[model samples]
Target: MQAKLRMVDAIIEVHDARVPLTGRNAYFEQNLLADTSKPHILVFNKSDLIDKKYRQPVENEMKSKDKKVHSIMWTDFKHKPMVAAADLIDIVKDSVTNMQRYNRDYRTEYNAMVIGIPNVGKSSLINAVRNRVLGKKGKATRVGDRPGVTMAVLNRITVHENPKIFLIDTPGILAPKAENIENAMKLALCQTVLETTLSESLIADYLLYYLNKRQLFEYVTEFQLKSPTDDIYELLFHIAKSRRLINKSDKDCKPNFSAAANFFIACFRSGRLKSDRFMDFDLLNKS
Candidate 1:
């Protein structure tokens, strides 16, 4: 929040579409709604992963609390950047208009800051924006696909001729020190370092439960998994077999079920499962 206050005219909180609620900062909703200084735009990135059915429900929920929400379904490298940049401009324009109407002095000359957890595509979006505006080819410094790729916040030049806008890219936050349930959910959804922080078993269970609830029981039956077990390794082994994940080492033909299990869990968490496995909010509420 301090960084946002110091650097930019408005704050655009980027979140993954696959796990919108999970990818938010614990204090983000509170801080954003409470703050009267500058307006906020919640940019739901990676919308292509989310099922069409769940999108409206989530958006409706957000709009119910705050009417200023705008959503975009982003996919592919060619279009995502352009869409992101355009959306930022629209959001800034709307905020500026409101501020002026109320006789407030919210700065409009500076570009809006794009903030979010790691691997949320802040840099990629920025680069795409710049490419269109500048007519020159240069990459954004902090862009990367792997986890923990961005170690620190960065400031980059915008495409506008007069430096009218700037992009302040922040490092992806780890689990907050405080044990807030909201924070945990956000980290699980947004933070790129999925394997180290969250247990593989937890992710597996989430997938299993989601698939089962959707009446997609083949996922479990195909793998021939036993009932929920405390053993992470055993659960992973079952998942690997079900997914037909096997190791083909020249030295030993043994299936690398352990490695496959980890990969599967990661993919599921990242929304690469190629199926609509929306989180059962009822279960989450119960937990």
Candidate 2:
């Protein structure tokens, strides 16, 4: 990452809107933020997953705490992506226009990099921008639910033509370990880290912890539980039995808790189950 610092004019740091304040890769600060001396826009993608009320608060908190984050905005990649793409362009332009040129002053066109932890809509954002800005029809990068979709540093793809804007997409990378246990759980629960890298049941357990701690009991009814309980096994049993997500499909067979846990985690990550808009802001700061 350090080797390519000279190649771009700005950095677009994408993170999941659900976890706006946590699970940001520490490496970004070391490699990109240090030398770029240019525009750095932190975009919280997947904004549809969280409610709208928390957006300003999240941006404000980040600016107050992390001085490096000069510009912050949110986008939902699933709906009206073109509109989101335009907003992203405006963000980059505003940041770039305001900054004093200490780095690449001779460059006429704009070059930027799309980077963040895994599965945070980096590629999808690129596709949206291409479709919106360039009238292009298809994705330039592969996007998947799991991590490591783009394995290497990719060639620059043209998104805008007037000012000649291009974005380089890179593989998502995380720290060797999280800064703490709570951060680890948040990262795992958000599916930024691979499920195989962490225990699925434990990740689901963390989801439960997050929901219950916030009194976001929507999971109970979503999974057919009569009421909320602290016991993860109880919720898993109900979810498995209700969804019939068991192996050796005999009605009398025991509930497949693992399968149930996996399903629950998927729902959480996909936004089928969501908390208040202020979830991350309230919970992570407390932790």
Candidate 3:
């Protein structure tokens, strides 16, 4: 953000709706807050994935603290290009216009930087916005599913009316070094790290605990998963079997239980398990 600030007039921070708090760069948020001169806009993307039950609570939480922050629920791929472009134009126009009206010659031309963490749809958002503005599709450089796909920042140009807008796309953020559980969880969920510091078994246990509390035991029971009698390892083994994650050993031709357990846990963490299990934020605060 600091590097892009030198080139841009304003910053639009895009974050995921399902994990808004987790989908932000701690460094950018802190540094941007300290520099009051750089006008910033908060955009929550992927509202389509949010559960209706939790949406109001999340919105209320954000609004209660920062009332000026703007949010839009982005969905419908067919119309997303137009909607996103219009929204970006509107935001930049309003922000820059006010600065100019106040005789702030320092901030002119409305150069905006699009910033966000990995897999939060930042590239997609930029492409959509550019397509609408240019009356043609503008390609934004993007990497694959792997973490740290964006190793270096790149600039993309968009023409709006008579002026050219420079949009700087930055690398996906890894959590600033922190030890707090909440921060850790946020980093783990947002970044594209292939291997997490937290153990897979621990994550699986947490998922189990969350599901049991939400009365979503049926998900576990659907596969006829057996509850662990006493040992967590045994439970994981059972989970692997239920999920049908088996590997035959080369030597003895035995099922590779360890490999199976890892596969199942990875699927659970990546949301492939179709579990709505999430760490209860409200419950965390109460406790």
Candidate 4:
């Protein structure tokens, strides 16, 4: 990433809207931003999944903290047009033009690195901007529901023409160590890391705890539970039985707990469960 940093005119750090405060890679701030101080914008993707009320406050908090960041914008590529995907390119252009582009000041083409910590819609954001600006039909980059989809830093992808803009999509990189187990679980719940990296059951357990802590009990109705419960096993059993994710070959007819856990986590990720559709970070209480 450091090697390619010199080639780009700006930096675009894509992150999960659900976790505005948590699970962000600090390496980028320390190494990339502090060293070079390039024109940067923090794109909070998946804004659709999170509540809209937090937008202004989140933007304010982010801007106040990171003075190097030129702007902070939210984008939900899933629900296009509502949020102008083209705004990204405009922001990049304006920000780059305003700041010192170093050696690339005279260069007409704008190059930026789209980076984040796994599945925060880095590739999807690139595709949205590309399609919006170029009027292209297909994706310019590969994207997936899971994290670590883009395993390497890809070549420059043209997102805009005229005042030419190209984005370098890089793989999501998590910090070598998590600040705490809670933050680690938050990253897992958001699928910043692969499901296999952390056990499905463990992730689901954290999801349940998070929801219950926030008093978001819509999962009970969604899963057809009699009532909201703190017990992760109980919730999984209910989900398994209701969804018929159970083994019938055995006389006992035991529920597939692992499958149940995965389904529960998927429901949370896909915004199937109500209340807090997106797992929001309590920025006020953030450690």
Give per-model TM-scores.
Answer: 0.72, 0.90, 0.76, 0.92
Instruction: Report the backbone clash tally of model 2.
Output: 0
Which pairs, if any, clash in model 2? Answer: none
Backbone clash count for every predicted candidate, in the order shown = 1, 0, 0, 0
Candidate 4: which stretches are off by over 4 Å? 81-83, 248-251, 278-280
Judging by TM-score against the true structure, name the best candidate.
Answer: 4
Model 4, 80-123: lDDT tens digits are 73255778888888876677766666688878898888898888
Candidate with more favorable, higher TM-score: 1 or 3: 3
* Residues 1-287 of candidate 3: C-alpha lDDT, one tens digit per residue: 57557656667777766565545566775665455465667776655544556656666666666544554444422336577667767776666555533344654355777777666666666766667777765466563555566677776556365454656677777555544665554445434344467665555455455555555554455445554233446666665566655565455444455665466555654566665533335433442
Which residues of candidate 1, in runs, are more than 4 Å off?
A: 1-4, 29-33, 66-79, 101-108, 174-191, 218-255, 266-273, 280-287
Per-residue error (Å), model 3, residue 87:
3.7
> 37-57 in candidate 1: lDDT tens per residue?
556677766666556676666
lDDT of 1: 0.58
* Colliding residue pairs in candidate 4: none
Instruction: Point out where model 2 deviates above 4 Å.
Output: 97-99, 102-104, 249-252, 277-279, 283-287
Q: Highest lDDT: which candidate?
A: 4
Question: Model 3 compared with the native: what TM-score?
Answer: 0.76
In model 3, the runs with Cα more than 4 Å from the true position are 67-86, 100-108, 189-196, 226-235, 242-244, 250-274, 277-280, 283-287
> How many clashing residue pairs, candidate 3?
0
Q: Put down candidate 2 lDDT per residue, 100-193, tens digits, no spaces.
A: 7665678767777888988888999999988888888877889898777879988899887767888889999888898777788877777788
> Which pairs of residues collide in model 1?
111-165
